[model samples]
Target: MTRVCRLVAAALAITVPAGALVAKPAPKRAVAKVDWTRTFGTTSAGGYVVGNPKAKVQVIEYGSLTCPHCRHFAATAVKPLLANYVRTGKASYEFRTFVLNGIDLAATLVARCNGPAHFFPMADQLYATQPTWSGKVEKLSQADQDKLNALPQPQMMVSIAKTTGLLPIAASHGIPTAKAQQCLTSQAQADGLMQMIKGGEELGVQGTPTIFVNGKKVPAFDWASLEPFLKEAGS
Candidate 1:
């Protein structure tokens, strides 16, 4: 059994019916195994970038698209900070995927479906509309257990992603074919994502949306309080 699947099983054992308990199976996917290439500097699909290339502060967020906390940060804090700092070349931001489940991975794929140029915009939209889509996940999952519960599950993911404006962008960008391919099939990229998660752990990140300033970890969420740190990083 893959470590992640075992972890998932351990978690499900508590919430699911007794019949759901079973030996953990290897995840059908080892990690995304796709050929990925970036056509621009500081821009990669399924990733993020902001601020000047020479900016001293490099903030990397390892987030799941479906995570409410991540969405909250994007909506309530990150947006304003991006406008102030990222647009002014004072700080840079990057997002790495950390899939918590099949549904989360599906949502990530949809967010990345617009390639790099539209990735963050799609993500921003997703975060903005998170509550609506998040509520339907359970309803959508139960509608067709076979169709939805199956691994490599599609699970009305497109429907939910569309609510966030990603579908239209997908149509415009030709579905971020290469980027989505990289995310869904590339073992190396998957491993790289895992490494980022490990890096976050080493930095004492116990939850999603942990913020950093100038490569130094910040332990709080209050934007007003973090201003001094941002000022120093921006300097």
Candidate 2:
């Protein structure tokens, strides 16, 4: 089937039964019950971290707000990762910013506006609705587009956020327009985002959704590829 479906099926195959010719139901795999009290906090680099602070395996995902593949991975992989690994104290997960463009930068700012507690959920919302917000640019007139392109970097980001409906998305997630505007205009936030981008570059992140397990780059790019690494590390 499609790539995402294939990836998901492969992921399921890890825990689910492999037989297809037989008519018997597959045996259920037992997942550890989530504690729901796992630690959540901000990393020194401004990324969000969730799970046991001293877990043996650490997963760092460098993702762009504008990347569809990153969104797909988030949708299909994160839930299981959190439940089976992070919740069980087998591994910890962190998300790092890797902005691909101005839109990505703006989205990152808005997502981080509410701080660490809201960061992951806001990020999930942004990725789930990425196409809606990102597609709004194509509907703008040439003059308007040029004006947007001509604004100072911070204001340009704010304008992009408003134009692309990202502001409303933030508001719905508890950040108001005024506060979001402030976040978009914050020089400190901009600097942090830039630094994150630089850090991603130094880590050799050539694309969105680049994952690292225990400081080693994951050779495979999908959930199926990552599962084995997590298992090996956790084991």
Report the Cα RMSD per candidate. 27.2, 18.1
| Model 1, span 64-107: residue lDDT tens | 77788788777666776677666666666777676775556656
Candidate 1 colliding pairs: 32-185, 32-186, 32-187, 33-185, 33-186, 33-187, 34-185, 34-186
User: Candidate 2's C-alpha lDDT?
Assistant: 0.86
Q: What lDDT score belongs to each candidate, Candidate 1 first?
A: 0.60, 0.86
Q: Please, what are the lDDT tens digits per residue for candidate 2 over residues 1-235?
A: 9999999999877754566547987899997676632578888877889888888999999998899999888887777788778888888889998888888888889989988667788888888888888878868899988998899998898999988988888888898999999999999998998898888889898898998999999874666878999989878
- The per-residue C-alpha lDDT of model 1 at residue 221 equals 55
Off by over 4 Å in 1: 1-47, 141-147, 152-169, 172-192
TM-score per prediction, in order, is 0.64, 0.81
Candidate No. with top lDDT? 2
How many residue pairs clash (N, CA or C atoms closer than 3 angstroms) in each of the candidate models, in the order given? 8, 0
